[model samples]
Target: MKLMLKYLKRYPKLILLNILGIFSFVAVQLGIPTVMAWMIDNGIGNSDIAYIKKMGGIMLIVCVLGGAGTILLTYASSRISTNMIRDIRNDVFIQSQNFSHTEYNKFGVSSMITRTTNDAFQLMLFSNMLFRTALLAPVMIFISVFMTIKTSVSLSLVIGGSFPFIVAGVIIIAKLTNPLSKKQQKGMDQLNRISRENLTGVRVIRAFRKSEYESERFAETNDNYASNSKKLFKIMSFTQPAFFFLLHLAMMAVFWISSLMIDKGTLQVGQLVAFLEYQFHAMFSIMLFSMVFVMYPRAQVSANRIQELLDEEPLVKTPTNGITAENKGVVEFDHVTFQYPDGELPVIKDVSFTANKGETVAFIGSTGSGKSTLINLIPRFYDVTSGSIKIDGVDTQNYDLKALRQKIGFIPQKAFLFKGTIEDNLRFGNPNATPEEINHAIEVAQAKEFIENKPKKLQEYISEGAKNVSGGQKQRISIARALVRKPEIYIFDDSFSALDYKTDATLRAALKKETKESIVFIVAQRISTIMNADKIIVLNEGEVVGMGTHKELLKSCNIYYEIADSQLTKEELER
Candidate 1:
């Protein structure tokens, strides 16, 4: 909350106006019982109808001013609160884009989404309410108690004795409900994760007939969230009854004592009437404090959650004077060893390889053999666990991320497109790309056919993640998006898996001419996909067992030879 309060510094004038408004409201509220005390004890005691009418007029005007102040403060508080929340939400989202891969993975995707949305919203609720009511509540409560004690200290005993119970109730309920509310937010994360996963892979779940299992998983998460919510509310529910009961009991005691004092000729009936209104004021103030009690704990937890993400420092940083290069493509992996974070050993052990400018290098490995892992390291996405990767004879780590990524183009196995027109998605690779450049890239990636067939051609709209298009079409558009940039090095991580054999052959053939001056690396499962490359690597059990042309590997390496034999037909092998 302190972190959030820093934003209020931007709105000092507005905050002051809101404070003035709250003060005005509390002033009129406090004056109400005070004026009543005078009307009963002074005006009615003398039977001065004119004096009573005058006090009544003043009270009515004070009430109008209070109502006006209420509107002003509520409006001011809402505007400030909404703007502050917008700033916070923007910062959270922008910072997320800069988070290191490890940092992002640490919290998990679902948790980040939950924090950005639900947790931030909780903080907003408390901020809005506190701005409007928390400050005024104390003003009314303090002054009311002071007035009651000044009138008669003996009657003050009623407030002194029972207000403690209300405070205690708030404390106990806050302590119990707070942790449960935090747990509920975590459960909400799991629920969001299940929903997102199902939506993203709806086809696969349906194809495999796993709807029942997915439904069970979703229900478990929903029930957990519901149970946590119920626990928090059950505790929070104590405030209302406990407060009103304490107030009424205290009021009863005050009435009995006031009657005795009046009979004893020590207190007046009008004074007693005014004293009851002050008691009501004190009780309502406690109610407002109860609300603050309920809101603060939830906000504190939300603030903590948001702070964790903001405080996270990305593990990777560019050097003070990072290099920026303009050389032709030259990628080298020198004695590179790496592993997934939880793996027992390095998945790519003591691997050394180089691909010169304009050369094509392919990694051919079976599943779990670390081909994709090697491809990922070149761009510094998942950095090498040990050893160095270089581009243009300079260590990639020494290049600012902007300079390193700008020169390399990537096409992943799973194609993703944003919600926009085809032209908009294509322009993401190079926003300055001309119409001619976009059209040419589309032709090269074999996406032109479908794009041209659309009603709006390049302007055709795509739904989120390109759900409007087929898998192969989306892959082609993704490739076109990369090609439009004309990057120095293009890495295709099995980007052709969905294409038919004929399309795959055509795509590779087109690449030979269009990408002749650009280095190309591909990770492939099919022998035919990487067969025509200048050089190929075969990784197995975290080591490179073969590095040669297709014919040379067939002659020399058992694993590579077996792969080629198993994946190719006899007649094709003879050819």
Candidate 2:
């Protein structure tokens, strides 16, 4: 909750203006009852028509002033609350962008989305209420109580006597609902996660004929959320009615007690009526304060959630004073080891290798041999747990992250494209890339032919995630996007798997010539894809078992020979 005060401080002028507006509103409201009391006693009781008319006009003017003040108060609250929420939402999103892969996995995508959207919205509602009603409630109560004391000290006791009970009830209700609110928030995250999974994997669910199972899973989460909400609302339902009952009881007591004083001629009729009005105002103000207790516990939960994300320290820290190297593409992994945070064993162990300019270094192994993990370390996606990774004679950790990443063009195992034109996607790598450069990259990736067939060519619309395109087409476009950068190093993590053998062969042939000045690292499952590389690395489990050219490895490495034997003919293997 303290985290929110920083944003609130941004609008000092608005806060002052809102306070003034609320003061006027409460003053006018409290003044009207006093005016009516005077009219009833001095005007009607004394048989003076001019006094009645004069007081009536003053009451009408006070009503108009109160209405205007209410409008100002509402405007100020709306502007301040909405702007604060917008700033907070932006800050949360920006912080999430800085999160490393480890932090991302820790929170999960669905939970982050819920925090950014639903949780922020909850804070907005609470802020609006705080500015509009909660702050005014206390001030109104104090003024109304003061007026009651001035009118008749005896009637003031009614308000003071009822205060303690209302305070105790609010405290108890808040404590009861606080834990339930946290549970409700967690349930919402689960519901969102399941819904996102179902939407993204709808085709898989249909293919497996498990829609009923998915429905049941969704229903279970939905029911849990519904149950928590019901309990919280049921508790909150007691608040308004209970407060109203207390107010009515106090009003009745005041009437009964004040009548005795009026008959004895100790308290005037006008003073008695004014005192009753003040008592009502004071009790109603307390009721408004109670409303805050109902909504605030839930919003406090949301604020804490947002604060947790902001406070999270990323596992991979960016250097404050980082360096860069000007050397041509040269990558080295020296005694590298990596283990997942929750895994029992290291995924890659004591691995050492290097790839230099104009070289095509390839890695091949059985699935889960740390092929993708090895490449990921080069860009500092997950820093090596043990050893150092260097680029152009400088350790990767020493280089500024942006400068280091700009030197490499990496294509992940899965290709993703934003919803935009082909040209927009290509420009993502290098915004200043010329048309000629984009065309050259498209041709090298073997995508120019298909792109030309489209009526809009480079301007054609691509759907979100590039779902409208085939896997092979998306892969080619991803490759082209990377190429547009003309980076010093190119990494393809099984990027050719979706392409047909002929297209893969042609793309590789074109890349050989196109990337002659740059270093390239390829992770592939197919033996043919990597057989003709400058050097080949063979990994088994987490260890590298072989390192040599195809022929050299076949002669010296048993694992390489077995892998080759399964994928190549005897004559092909000998060649």
Candidate 3:
């Protein structure tokens, strides 16, 4: 809630205007009861028709002015509240984006989504209602009290005694709802996580024939969410009728007590009638106050969640006096080791390697062998656990990330394409890349034929993630995207997996000529892909088992010999 209030300060002027509107609105609303009191006491009770008509007209005019105030302020406050939400939403996104890999993993994907959407929405709801009802309620309540006391001391007792009941009601309901609202937010995150998993892995679930199991998992989370919601509502249900019944009872008490005085000739008929109207105003004010309190608990839970994300500082940071640029195409890892944020064991350990300018270094290992992790270290995607990785003799930690990453081209195993044309996706690599530059990149990636054959060529529209294209085509586009920049170091992390043996052979052959000036690093499982490379590294169990040429390793390390023998014939492997 404190964080939310800080964001509200951005629209200080608008908020001040809104407060003024609420003040005027409450003044007019309070005036109505006063006019009614005057009409009933001085005009109707005395049987003065002219006074009654005049008071009625004044009351009607105040009601109209109050209505106008309500509408104008509602529109303005909504704009302020909505714009505030937009700012918060943008800030959360920027904060999350700035978080390091370590910090991001701590929150997880689904919880982050919940914070950005559900939590921000809760704050929006609270602020929107607070501007409209919060200010007016207390002011009207105070005014009603003062007006009743002026009418008479006995009538003030009629209204003020009921204050304790509504106050106690609000406090009790707020306490019960605070915990339930927190639980509700957690349950929502779990439900969102379940749904996201089901959508993304729908094929896997069906393939494994585990639909029933997944359905049960979803049902368990869904039921928990529904049950929690019902429980909170049950608690919340106490406040409203409890408020109405208590407040109306106070009004009835005013009527009851004032009636006796009227019969005794101590109070006039119009005075009793006026007292009844002020009693209703007092009750309505408390009802409005109770409504705002109800939203507070839910908003507080939301605010805390958002604050956690915003306050997280990225683990990776630029040094205070860090240099921005470095020599390109030379990478060295000295005793590098790494582990995922939550992993029990190290993924890569004590790995030492170097790839100099115009050299090709290939990492060949089985699945879970840390081949991709080794490549990821060069670009500083995940900071190394213990050792230093340097580019051009400068420690990676000392170089600004923007300058460090610009010299490297990275393509992940799973390709990602944004919503745009083939040209636009490629141009993402180099925004100022020319049309001829685009075609040359496509040719280098071996995607020229297919792209040229497209109905709209580079103008061919693509949906999000490029679902409109085939798997192999998406892979080529990703390659073309990376190739357009012609970075000093080109990292292909199992990039040739999707292409057939023939296409993979041709692509690698073309890359040799095109990438002569670039230091190429390839992580592949296929023996033929890295067989002719300048060097080959074999990783197993987080350690470098062997580092040598293909033939050199086949004649040396047993692990390398066994891997080569299993994939290729012993006669061919030995040769």
lDDT of each: 0.87, 0.92, 0.85
Give the Cα error of residue 446 in candidate 1, in Å. Answer: 0.8
List where candidate 1 sits over 4 angstroms from the true fold. 40-50, 263-265, 268-270
* TM-score, one value per model: 0.93, 0.96, 0.94
Q: For candidate 1, lDDT tens digit of each residue in 1-575?
A: 57777888988887988888888887787777778878887898899999899999999998999998888888889988888888889999988887767777899998899889998899889889888778778887898898889878999988999877777778888888888878987888899889999998999999999999999989988988899988888777767787788888898899899989999999988788778888888788879878888878888888899988888877666677788776857888899998766668788899999999778999987798998878888777777888999898899899988888899889987888989999999999999999999999998898888888999999999998787899999989999999999999999999999999999899888888889999999999898989999999989977999999988888888998788889898876666
- Cα-based RMSD of the predictions, in order? 2.3, 1.8, 2.3
Tens digits of per-residue lDDT, candidate 2, 1-575, equal 69779899999999988998899899898999899999998999998999999999999999999999998899999999999989989999988877878888999899999999999999999999999889999999999999998888888888899999999999999999999999999999999999999998999999999999999999999999999999999999999899999989998989898999889988888888778778888898898888888799999999999999989987776788887656757888899999987778999999998898999999999998989998998888888889999898888998988888889999889988889999999999999999999999999999999999999999999997687899999999999999999999999999999999999999999999989999999999998899889999999898999999999999999988999999899999878
lDDT winner: 2
| Candidate no. 1 TM-score | 0.93
Model 1's lDDT to the true fold? Answer: 0.87
Candidate order by TM-score, decreasing, is 2, 3, 1
| Candidate 3 residue-wise lDDT, 172-220, digit = tens | 8899899999999999999999999998788899999999999999999
lDDT of 3 at 227: 95
- TM for candidate 3 is 0.94
Q: Model 1: clashing residue pairs?
A: none
lDDT of 2 at 77: 95
What's model 2's TM-score?
0.96
